[model samples]
Target chain A: MRSSYDVIIVGAGPGGSITAKTCAQAGLEVLLIEKRQEIGDPVRCAEGVGKEGLIHHIEPDSRWIAAELKGSMIFAPDGTEIKMSEEASSQKAGFNLERKIFDRVLAQQAAMAGADVMVKTRATGLLRSNGSISGIKVMYMGEVTEIKASIVIGADGVESKVGRWGGIDTSLKPVDINTCTQFLVSNIDAGEYNKFYIGEKYAPGGYLWLFPKGEHTANLGLGILGSKCGTVRPISLLHKFMETYMPQGKIIEMVVGGVPVSGPIKQTVANGLILVGDAARQSDPLTGGGIINAMDAGKIAGEVCIKAKEKGDYSVKILKEYEDRWRATIGKELSKSLMIKNLLIKVSDEQLNQLAHSLSGIDTSKMALPKVLPILFKKNPKILWELRTLFI
Target chain B: MSVIVNRYKCGYCGACVGVCPAGALELVETWIEVDNTCTSCGVCAKICPVGALVVIK
Candidate 1:
């Protein structure tokens, strides 16, 4: 690998790949490195994203789309199933991806866009020059090497070290982080609907999910509030869930990771560096969804980084524009999601059942959080005083 | 050489299972099991998010 480049993107996940593709297409020397020997093996994501937002950025590829979703069902502890059909699924109509293949295709796209991609190459630490971030020190094939860049994009993920190394405050409180576990099971009837289960029993301070991949196959997963998981572990809870629901199913794959679900961090950029995807805590606080958001952040960072490159100045001033642009896209929604998530956790199971039962008939597909209260308050206007912020 | 997981401390996020180069580690509902195929390269222990997996060389 060359010892230097115009841009160095750490992590070849969707976010990093998108940034690399955009930047390389703009005619910059880009190097994208991944720690894994393979680009997308040992996938950690559940791989559900909105078609509207994602299709707006990239074309659909059948090789990676595991299942085309038509709708979603949210199950409350009391067995109330709130269905949002495709016609009404404004924000949820999308696809369940074979992330192992999906993530690979993205990195391949980056390579096709003229970015040099490397696997099994780990960024050991950040490289510095003149007291500012420049590139990264990488280890590959048992050798340590320094690579310089005009800008570095860290899409490293939930426990992102890039931000901390580059002086950005990326620390997430336990309450903001969701510890997740996923299992790919076969020989089960998953149907086409993506399902989400809420209640402390299924997921303490979090939720459980089933993203169907194909006929009789599904990705079963759950995320628990990091702070709330004291003696309770995700596996124990998931085991019980499976025993109760899919006792005959067989697990084919398993993964574990954390999703930053509170909101964007205080800052995602610093001199000569930018953070995107989970690194910036860009995942939705309500659903812990981030595939599309990461791609959006990547596109913005790619464009802004190109501008910074041409100007020959990679200061925080220029990099801050990336943050501003990112925030403009999904900042408010994420903040609101965080608020809703916090409030939901405080809600009793009875309230969730009531809320689910109330909206189970709504014709709305997207079912935006703000619209929930008007219907909810109509049924029980007495508690509206305390939970008024949810409507706002 | 092999990998071991302390079930009590293990959050069972499957980080070790995901990183195991040999595909010898699997997280069953009860615990993380290290099978006969394990080469014990220690990648699992290194990548354990909760520091539950330990490698005894």
Candidate 2:
């Protein structure tokens, strides 16, 4: 890496790559770095993204699109299955991605857009000048060096250190995190729809998901809340679930990780520094999805950086625009989802079965969640009252 | 040792590093390092999805 550039973005994930691409397209000198030797290896994500949100960034390509889903099925602990058709599902239609390829494609796009991309480059610390952020200290190829930049963007994933080093409070409480594990299983009949199983018996304070990758193969995973994890590990819970539900399936690969269900942090900007993606806690609290959210935040960050460049200012005041813009859009959804997630965890398994039963009668093909929400509210007025923000 | 990491099972996803309240854990590329700041709260051990981190008194 050179000694100086207009911007330095840490992590070449979807968020960082998008930010780099956007900034470079605007003629800003950009440097995007990934600590991994390969830009998208060691994938940790389940790789499901909404079709609508994805098309906004790049067109879906067969090389990376693993499966196109048309609907979803929610299985309550009591074996009550509630089906949702394309229209009923929130994202209408969705795609399960091959993140290994998709992330690299995004980084390649950023590189093609003129951003200098490097792998095996890790940021060690933030370089501060007179109590103000200036740039970053990176270790590239076993050599430590200081690279100066007008603005530094932290697009790092959940293990993000940039935000913390920059003095931003990005801490997550035990209750705010979901400890998760997944397996790539072959010889499974997952069909074409996404499947979800919920209840304390299956995955306490969380749920299990089966996202089909292709014919007879699927990504089966579960995420349990940290506070609810007493003695049973997430992987153990998944094993029990598999033994009972998918005994014939063979596990070929295992992935373990955590998702921030804490919603967005209070401040994502410091003097000459900004945080985006998982670093800013932008992942969805309800579903623990971050891919689309990260891309959205990255887009906004790049746009704000451009405006800041025009004014020759990279101070906290100018950088706050990125936070404000994302808060107005993605942040609003995260807040509501957090409230709903908090309430959902408190619900009993019996109540969930009741919920599924209540919705089983509707013409699911034409029904949207909003259409059935009123009927549900009538049955459970207490939850409806708590979720008032969603209505008004 | 306050915390012991089973690198064999660790996926290096940084889940433990993210939930370390004391900020004592760091993901150094493919492995994780526990620093002196660890409070032995067992939070990292409990939150490690694969049971890779063990906190022993």
Candidate 3:
């Protein structure tokens, strides 16, 4: 392996791969590493991505698309369902992806763009020189080797060591993390629309999702506040949910993971090292999804890395530009989403049922979730009074 | 890279070894260890049946 490169990315997930691909395309030396034997395996997500969000970063490929969605169904605790049409769902109604294929495609794009990819390699530590990141220490095939790089990008997911090693505070409070469990089940019948179930009984402080992958298969999952559900395994909760909702379905693949429901980290870059994806807590605070945000952050980080390379400056001060740029792009939406998440958590089951009823037949085209709050409140001013606290 | 496996939470199902890209994970006396070349990708931590593995920097 070469001892040095212009850029070294720690993970080959969406964020890292996109950064590497972008930099490589700009004629910079880049190395992308994946700790897994396969570029995409042991899928950790619900495999859902927004159509518009996916299109914003890279062109969609048929190989990765499992199903295209038209809309979503929102269910209250009492099972009252509110269906939102595609025209009204905005980009929030995205597609259910085949993550294995989707992740591999991103990594392949990076490799094709001249980035060196090393699978089964782990970045163990940061190589530092006088308090600045100079390179990385990697363990590959039982041999510890040091690789030098001008810039290092950490796309290593929520529990990102790269960020910690680089002296960036990536710690997430228990309240900020959502424990998620999902299963790919067969023999289920659900509409083309993705379904969301909300209530403390279903998933306290979070929600359950039923994403149809095909006519007979779907990814069924739920996320709950990590701190509130002490010692209750997310997988067991998932089985309970499945038994209650689709008792006859057989689970084919089980996936357990955590989603960083926190907003973006205060700092994403520092002196030759930058963080992206879950590592940077770029996932949606309300929905606990990261594919879109990760890719978006990756693109911005990649662009910034190229500029820094050209200017021969890899200082933290120089990289702050990347953080500022992304904040301008998606930061506002993330903050708004976080507020919604908090409000959703505080609502009672009865309130949710009422809210569903109010929104049932309403046309949502050109309207966002927040915009619908007032209309629901008008139906019962008491509920509106209780929810008013959220806006403040 | 070293991986600390919490025996209390580890089911030893070997999912970590199955998904490890570096082939640096294995069941040793009912425990998983970071082989000499372990990359610390935390894939093992991510795939562990019981969330037993925690990667420390």
Candidate 4:
């Protein structure tokens, strides 16, 4: 890499790659780096993305679209299922992707847009000049080099150190993060609909998910709240779950990760620095889905960054535009999701069973969270009274 | 007491780094490094999805 660039983006995930593509296409000098030699090997996510949010940035390709889900089924601990309506779940209607290929394609798009792509280049610390964040200190092939930049974007996933080096707290408590483990299993009856299981018996503070990846194979995973984890880790819990649920299935691969369910951090920008994707905790607090939010934030950051370059100003004032724009869009929903997640954790398994029973009579074709939550709140007011704040 | 990491099993997902209250864990792309700041509280061990970490006295 050269001694300097207009923008240096850390991490080559959806967020970083999109930002790089946008900025490079806008004629800015951009360098995007990935710590790994490969962009997306050993996938850390469940690889699901909503079609609408995804198509907003890039067209779908069969090479990476593993499965198209019709809807999702939520199973309470008692085995009562709540099937989301086609239209309602259509909001979530999307594809299970092969992230190994998907992430590479995104980075390739960035390169095509004229951004420099470097792999196996890890950012070890931030470069500060005269009390202003200027660039990054990176280690490549065991040689550390300082690359200067007017702006740095931390798109570096959940174990993000870039944010910390730039003085953004970015720390997560045990209760705020989910320790997740997933397995790719074959020889099972995988369906078009994704399945979710909830309650302590399944995941305690989190939930279990089965996302089919076509051809009788599926990604089965569960996340447990870090605080709730005991002698049994998520991997062990997942194995036990598999024994009871998909005994016929044979495990093929394993992936482990942590999702920040803490919503967005208080601040995502420091002078001359910005954070995106999981680095900024942009993932959904309820669903742990961040690809869309990350891309959305990256788009906004790109715009703000372009404006900053044009004005010849790279200060917090210019970067705060990104913070405001993302907060106006993704932030509001994330806040609501956080409240919901907290409520879900507080509600007992018995209450969840009751909720499943109370909603059983509703027509599945018309069932949506907006409609179902109100009915649930009305029926279980004693337990769900806190939900009033969300609707109100 | 300190934390031990099973390098072979670590996916380097950084789940342990995020939950380390002492900020003792660092993800080095290929592996996780536990620093002296670790109190051996075993929080990272508990949260390691692959069970790759342990608190050893």
Indicate which candidate wins on lDDT.
4
Q: For model 2, report DockQ.
A: 0.77
- Local distance difference test, per candidate? 0.79, 0.87, 0.78, 0.88
* Between candidates 2 and 4, the lDDT winner: 4
lDDT of 2 at A253: 85
Q: Per-prediction TM-score, please?
A: 0.86, 0.96, 0.86, 0.96
Model 2: per-residue lDDT, tens digit, B1-57? 479999898889898888877778888788998889888999888788888888977
When summed lDDT is taken over every stretch of 10 residues in candidate 4 chain A, the lowest stretch is A84-93
What interface-residue Cα RMSD does candidate 1 give after superposition?
9.6
By TM-score, how accurate is candidate 4? 0.96
For model 4, residues A108-149, the per-residue Cα lDDT tens digits are 999999999999999988998877789999999999999999
Which one is best on DockQ?
A: 2
Task: Please give the lDDT score at residue A357 for candidate 3.
Answer: 80
Each prediction's DockQ? 0.09, 0.77, 0.09, 0.71
Lowest lDDT 10-mer window, candidate 2 chain A? A83-92
Question: Any idea what lDDT model 3 has?
Answer: 0.78
Error of 3 at A54 (Å): 0.8
lDDT sort, best first: 4, 2, 1, 3
Task: List runs of model 3 lying over 4 Å from the truth.
Answer: A85-93, A365-371, A377-392, B1-57
A141-215 per-residue lDDT for model 2 (tens digits)? 899999988889998888888988888867678788888999999998978788889999888888999999988
Superposed by TM-score, candidate 4 places the C-alpha of residue B13 at a distance from the truth, in angstroms, of: 1.6
Q: Candidate 2, which segments miss by more than 4 Å at Cα? A: A86-92, A367-371
The residue-by-residue lDDT of candidate 1 on B1-57, one tens digit each, is 887788877765444553454656654334676888888776555434455777878
